[model samples]
Target: MLASFRERFSMLAAVLALGVLVGSPDARAETLVIAGDPWCPVNCEADSQRPGIFVELARDIFGEAGIQVEYRVVNWARALHDARKGRIDAVIGAARNDAPDFLFTVTPVSHSRMCFFTRSNSRWRFTAVSDLGGQRLGAVKDYSYGSVLDAYLLSHAEDPTRVQLAHGDRAFALNVDKLLNQRIDVVMANAWVMENWLREQGLGGQLRNVGCRTPDLPIYLAFSPALASSPAHVELFEAGLRRYRADGRLQRLLQRYGVSEP
Candidate 1:
């Protein structure tokens, strides 16, 4: 009976040791928790074989630095909020404008030109922000398009009679329906995202891009201050991104996803 008890105690100790080795926080050192909107072609859900154009690029770049990645798909607002609160390690494919609290990298993970779309028959010719007065616009709830557009959204939308702006969770997809039903007159979104969505929804050529040819928004994988390893991680990621760009791997990846270089 004494011998049997000793053997059982030894087995229990070994199992506990193994559990510590497996469950230690240090074991997850190089793993990053990333979250974002699953904007197709721009950034897709994790289950997707290729993910999305920028999602794969970020994975490869960070992987080059020996980091493993886990992604969560959520609304843009929530993604930014969680990153700000340090519930996650980083925000994927985000701009500094999107999350001012997060630290951004000099290396951009992806590129996207912002544009506005209008129905073909609508007479909304956009030469300037003043022209947008009196027209209804569809915009994503938490999106920061650009300085000019953001200013207009903040200042002009106060009076619904002047420049009425409608907000939605899935702004691009919802805007398509709104435009068809005349619920909104314009949609402000990424050029590529909107184009892909329009094609998928079988509304190609139905809307015209009539906004300013704004410069592309260079997206970066920004880190949350709540993360203890943020500074070191951001440095490693920037180095990895530089190497990725130098090797021309980014171009090949974009081509695979039918995305163009900006």
Candidate 2:
């Protein structure tokens, strides 16, 4: 009886030791939380099977290194704020000027040219800053439209006739609604993002890009500056991005989203 009890105890201890050696399934994979507004083809719907290009890229790259990406949709301002406070991992589809304090990968994931959109028949085209004098401009809050436009927007922000900023995760869509309803004369957004949006919504015939004055700016997968792991995350992204570029995965992914390579 004593010998049988000793054998059973040894077997139980061995099983427990093996379990400790293996660890829990949850312990095997690290979770990375990323959040941003829905800037389609860049980062789209949350909990979607086809979350945007960057979201997929992050999952693909980080998954190889035992990391899982959790994407969420938050308003741009909140996303930026959370990232700054170390409450999140990264913010997708950000221009450097958009969050200069955030940590960034060495290479840009894409490029953006901010442009003004008008009704297909509107004679108002943005030729100079003077052209903005009489037009009501609709823009997403917390977005940077470069120095010249930013300055103009700041000076006129209080006047509804001059500038109206949309807030919320769906701010871009709201701006589009305002434009289509003639509540605003012009809408400002990234040229490629807006083009994709119009094409996807079948509203291309309703709106047209008047002009783009701001230089094409590089966009990044900006990581939290406050996180201790941010630097490593940035490095991982930089290396993986280089590999993707070399292997043509980047081009293929961009094609899937109907976007050109940066």
Candidate 3:
């Protein structure tokens, strides 16, 4: 009877030890979820076989820092929404000051300019923001074009309906169609992306760049406020990024995706 009781106690103690080990915090590894729009060629993609340049650079940076990264390919709006909600730890390529809810790293991995696309044969020229006042302009829905353009549009809202905001998976296609059909006067897009899209669709020669919204738009790796607030992890990732940038590895990766150095 005594031997049986001792055996039972020993078994119970072993089970308790195992339970404690399983429940320990150290047993679980830390992972970061990064989200981006695959439509933005430099940032994200749907093809598992070919990752975007920014995605590849991010993976290398975070991997070197001993952090595991899970890439989530989402729509532009959803990706921004997730970043704001802390559902995503980071965003690969985001414009500076794009969102107030996120924190950006000090160094940018890439840069591009925002430009307007118009019909190839159109005589209309765009030199300033006021040039778009009387013309129908197609812009991405829910996107902030900064205070300057926003204020200008607000002042001229009644005149020719200054801006025509559009949305959906077919926004770009719709914009292009509008230009082709002479429905919308112009379409706004990032230069590199628009050029690539146009080339892919065999419409490159049919479109012409009217003007650029800004001289240069710097793209950075943005992190949710919640994630950035965690000093240890944020610092780890930032350090990794800095190392890549310093060593020119990030530039090489961007070049692989046809991103030009500025």
Best by TM-score: 2
Candidate number with the higher TM-score (1 or 2): 2
What digit string (tens of lDDT, one per residue) describes model 3 on residues 99-153? Answer: 6567766666667677888888888877888787568887765455555765764
Indicate the TM-score of model 2: 0.86
Segments of candidate 3 deviating more than 4 angstroms: 1-28, 153-160, 228-233
Q: Listing every candidate in turn, what is its Cα RMSD in Å to the true structure after a full C-alpha superposition?
A: 11.2, 11.1, 11.9
Tens-digit lDDT string for candidate 1 (70-179):
88887777888887787888877777787777888787877768877899987777777777777787777667777788788888666654444444346557767887
Which residue pairs overlap in candidate 3's backbone? Answer: none
> Which sections of candidate 1 miss by over 4 Å?
1-29, 161-169
Leading candidate by lDDT: 2
Better of 1 and 3 by lDDT: 1
Which run of 10 residues does model 2 get worst, by summed lDDT?
11-20
lDDT of 3 at 127: 81
Candidate 2 collision pairs:
none
- Ranked by lDDT, the better of candidates 1 and 2 is 2
Tell me the tens digit of each residue's lDDT in model 2 across 150-203: 899889999999999999978999999999999999998887678889988988
Clashes of 2: 0
Stronger candidate by lDDT (2 vs 3): 2
Clashes of each: 1, 0, 0
